[model samples]
Every structure is written in C-alpha cells, then in structure tokens.
Target: MQSLIQQYFPNVLLLKQEFINSTIETLYMVFWTAIIAGILGTLLGVILVATGPEGILKNSVLYNILEKIINICRSIPFIIMLALIQPITRFLTGTTIGTTAALVPLVIGVIPFFARQIENALLEVDPGVIEAAESMGTSPLGIIFRVYLVEGLPSIIRVSSVTIINLIGLTAMAGAIGAGGLGNLAITRGYNRFQTDVTIVATLIILVLVFASQFISNTLIKKTSH
Candidate 1:
C-alpha cells in the first residue's frame, strides 16, 4: 500500500501516515466537541427562548445574566479564546496541546455560537402554535418539546449544518497549537516546507468534508420540513 502510493504520488506519500493520523485527529476533535457543544447549546438556547420577555418562564434577572454571559463568551475570538483558556484547558485535559486539549476550547468556543443558532431556529417557530398549545393547557415542558423543538426541527438542522461547517474551520485553527489535524499538517508539513501539493490536498479534503455535511443536512431538512 505504502509502496504503491510512494510510486504513484511520491510527494504526498511521504506524509501519508501523517495525513491519515491528522484526519482521524480532526474527526475526533470535531465529533466530541460537537456532541458536547450541541447538548449544552441546545439547552442554553431553549432556556434563552423560554426565559425571554415573551417566554413561558420569563425572568428578567436570569435572562439578563444568561444573555450577557453568552454574548461575552461569543465576543471573544476563537484563537484568543484558545490562548485565554489555556489554564482551564490544561486543568480539564492535562495539557495545552494535542487533540484532547483542543477539545476544551473547541467546545467552549462553539457553545455560544451554536446556542445563538439554536435560539434563532427556535424563534422561527410560529408564535400562534405556541399560544394554541398553551391555550390547550400544555405544560411548559411539553410545549418546549413538542412545539418549539419539533416545529423548529428543520431550521435547527440547517443551523446545525452551518455550525458543523464552522467547526471544521475551527479545527484547522486548532492545529496552530499542535492539535494535529489537516490544518496542522498543512501548516507544519505543507506551508512550512513550501509543499504546495500537500497544502492543496489538505484543503481539498476539508472542502469535501464540508460539502458532504451540507448535503446530508440539507437532505434531512427537506425530508423533515413541510
């Protein structure tokens, strides 16, 4: 296998192992980060909507605090957040480098991003449906689950697709800190070494992944939506 690659694609063959490892690392980082972020973000977003001025459980104090916290966190740049949260990341993952360490910042950085997306998606649900549910004596929790989440499913899918694509880009930046992935491979072995072919290949792979994600998400949205 190695011999054949080397014979046919000598330039990339030398970094074939690194390519595979980096791809796996990126997938690992993105997958775990997305899971954690998706859960937290969904919860937080639902809370934001449910506690807003017109929400089922509106509370000025709680809504203000949560909104401010999300806004503050989202305001920080991802790269800066990566550097700013080094100590916390180290505490969580026991190191400030590698895929594991990168997960901390990735999850933290993406939570607010996806939270806002989820919030918007939920907001897009027709207010009349929610009112009708309430008029029928549906519990707050039931309305949230059946009305907001269910009605917002397609929009949520769309936003989730956007978030995942953004996450792919963030994973690339994570490579700057030695979080081994295609981004790191491109920078360290491709850019640093002036290997144009390597850089192009890494970029193309990322693009393919992004496109595939979009396609799947769009398909799901079309199937679920009216």
Candidate 2:
C-alpha cells in the first residue's frame, strides 16, 4: 500500500504536513471571509432591494449610492484589489502578509460580488407577493423577512454556493502573496519546483471543495423550494 502510494503523488506524500497545513490555511481564509462577508453583503443587498426605485420602500439616493459602490469595488480585479487595499489591510490586521492579512482583502473583495448576488436573489421574489403583504399592512421589515427572505432562500443558497466557489479561487490568488494556502504550496513547491504531482493534488482538492459546496447547495435548494 505504502509503495503504491509512494509511486504516485510522491511530493504530496512526502510534504504531507505542508499540504495539510496549507489546506487548513485555505479553509480558514474561506470560512472566516465567507462568514463576515456573508453578513455584510446580505445587509448591503437587503438595503439595496428595500431602497431601490421599485422597492417596497423606495429610496433612490440610497439605492443608487450603494449600487455605485458595489460596482466600483466589484470592478476592481482581486489581484489589484489585494495590492490596492494593502494599507487598509495592514491597518486592520496590523500587517499585510499571511493568512490573517489575506482575509481582509478576501472579505472586501467578495462582499460586493455577494451583495449583488443577494440582491438578484431577493429581486426574484414575486412582486405580487410583496404587494399582497403590503395590502395586509405587513410592515416593510415583515415583508422583507417573511416574503423576500423566505421565498428567496433557495436562490440564496444557490448564489452562496457560487460565491463560495469564487471565494475559494480567490484564496488561491491570495496564496500567491504569501497567504500560505494550497495556492502557495502549489506555486512555491509544486509549480515553481516543477513538481506536477503536487500541483495536481492541490487542484484536485480545490475541485473537491467546489463540487462539495455545489452538491450541498443543490440539496438545500431542492428542499427549500416548493
């Protein structure tokens, strides 16, 4: 068993601990960034939905401002955003390198993208449902939670899966800057060192993460949908 294992994926088997640590680092960045950005992005999205010109509570000023901001931030490429936001990252994390620092840009970078996703998901809710809720004198907050959130949950899960997959890819880019994740391992040791096996292993792990997230999202969507 060991000999066959050694025969294939030799670098990964040899650098087992590095691979393990790098994977953990990758998960850590993705986990925290997703959580933080998820909440903020959701809020941004909810506000956008609630305040848009066609929203139940229209506030063009707020909606337009938030829309422009989301566009500006989302327009910036993640790599350049990493460099562009370094000062802020340094201020937030007290340094601009490693897994912790990478998180700042990760969350900031994904927030706009996720916010747009959330807005789109919520917008998919039937306008008639919201109008009916308004007829019943259901408060704006009530409709948002009961109608928009409840009806849009399946879509939310789907978008979340997409966002997470994109985030995982971003983490790999983050690894390029000494964030020390699977990307770093793949780049510094695998690609840089011409070790194809290690690169394949890292790529495989990323694929697993994406597929697993998509599967879970699909299951939830099925269950959540009527």
Best by TM-score: 2
lDDT of 2 by residue, 1-226 (tens): 9888788878878899988899999999999999999999999999999999789889998899999999999999999999998999999999998999999999999999999999999999999988999999999999999999999999999999999999999999999878889999889899999998999999899899889989999999999999
- Deviating ranges (above 4 Å) for candidate 2: none
lDDT score, candidate 2, position 112: 97
lDDT of each: 0.93, 0.93
TM for candidate 2 is 0.97
**Model 1: CA > 4 A from native:** 1-9
What's model 1's overall lDDT? 0.93
Error of 1 at 203 (Å): 0.5
Best by lDDT: 2
Clash pairs (backbone) in predicted model 2? none
- Window of ten residues with lowest summed lDDT in model 2: 3-12
Count of steric clashes across candidates, in order: 0, 0
